[model samples]
Target: MMCGALYFTPIGRRDSCTPSEFARFENDEQKGSKGGRIHKNKKYGFKFVLLETRKGYSIIVGTWSGIAYQGENHERIESGPMITIRHPLWTKSDPRQDIPIMILTRAQAEIANDLSVSAAPFGPQEFSRNAKFVFALPPRFDYGDSTGTEEVREILRNHPLHPF
Candidate 1:
């Protein structure tokens, strides 16, 4: 299963795949977890939306503060908020599981918000392509050697893709 698979683009690697390509690959795998639960349970303070693009389907995730509202033909997700959170590195041991961190991007947030509103009137389901939205991945800081920690921090702090 390719669910939650993380793709890393090493520094100075010109052949790295774009986020859109990765999303398409994951979508083609058809191993994505359903977003129904996340959509229904707003108490978690997280919002989810599923989008159908020309490449394939992509899932959008964001928080309430970042998303203003969602609806069919009427959706708005502010592209200004940045979410920094820790995520577990499955390849690592238990105690060090939470080393991986990420900052969500504006494009990703918009996609999530658009998908959420598009499905809101109907239910938790996929909606047709929204020309204004595109699939993207958040910038993730993975666990590496001690020497790379600073580099990761620098990337997390300076990457322009992340929302300000």
Candidate 2:
């Protein structure tokens, strides 16, 4: 199956967040895990929201909400779980398992291996571990792209598309 990679960009050290900000981030993470709504921009399509990474843990929360800035890596990893962490904006259920987890292809996995990037598949039984947050590397994109891909990359790099 065709897949894409979403590169993990560090925003800040978890310890660096103010208490309120950390609380809010934790709250948002919990809500998403409990089936809260993941936001999407109507005009610009989807905003790849910010997911957090802590200093020690290997599991990271994928906000599954937020905006993707221009030129940011926007490839979707295929082997990752597409489990819905949030309720659909207009529906009671979302059947997708691709949004909140990172699944890598064999080739991508090898690339990740070479790059020393970890791509661990959460075991089916561990889905009930009940951890609200975790951290691991998001996939990296390295394959060559077409002209259209370059155009999209250019668009992502340009910031007028950013609302904030």
Candidate 3:
């Protein structure tokens, strides 16, 4: 699956100074799965979005770091801090056995509608198969103080995945 970031504005708000909210998952499959079951591990101070994908499901984990200004115009560029997809750390057993088939079917349909392609990209066989995938965000360059270096540093200090 392809992954990238997009800029979005909250509804009813239209001010340039208001930093655009950015969620880090977007591509052919995820464009449609805008909202999902969000699970927050408050004890760990982290949260994840449980998105239903065509084949099965995926989980995106991370938190929002801080805001930064971009380009010559110095436009706002806020990001979901250290976002990445996590696959089930499983072996031998099929993960689908645990999920209800009905949920998968609904999720698949949602993705198809989001795609809005003239022709269905996958056939019945593709839908029947079980699959899981993970994506890692590329390394980011520190924008120094412009991106709230001290804030990010503090967040990272307490980041759950800091060992990685």
lDDT of each candidate versus the true structure = 0.27, 0.27, 0.27
Q: Across residues 1-164, which tens digit of lDDT does each residue of candidate 1 receive?
A: 00111222222111243553322224222322542111121222232222111113222222222233333454344342222222222112322211121223435533443332221232112112123322233332233544335533443343212111
Q: Per-prediction count of colliding residue pairs? A: 2, 24, 0
Please give, for residues 56-150, the per-residue lDDT of candidate 3 as tens digits: 32333333222223334443323332333322331234222111111122333333233322223421111121222111222232233332344
Runs in model 3 deviating more than 4 A are 1-137, 161-164
Task: By TM-score, rank the candidates, best first.
Answer: 3, 2, 1
Please report the TM-score between candidate 2 and the true structure. Answer: 0.20
Please list all clashing residue pairs in model 3, or write none if there are none.
none
- Worst ten in a row by lDDT for model 2: 122-131
Model 2 gets an lDDT of 0.27
Residue 27 error for model 1, in Å?
Answer: 30
Worst 10 residues of 3 by lDDT: 95-104
**Distance from true location, Cα of 7 in model 3, Å:** 16
Q: Candidate 1: which stretches are off by over 4 Å?
A: 1-141, 162-164
Point out the worst 10-residue segment of candidate 1 by lDDT: 1-10
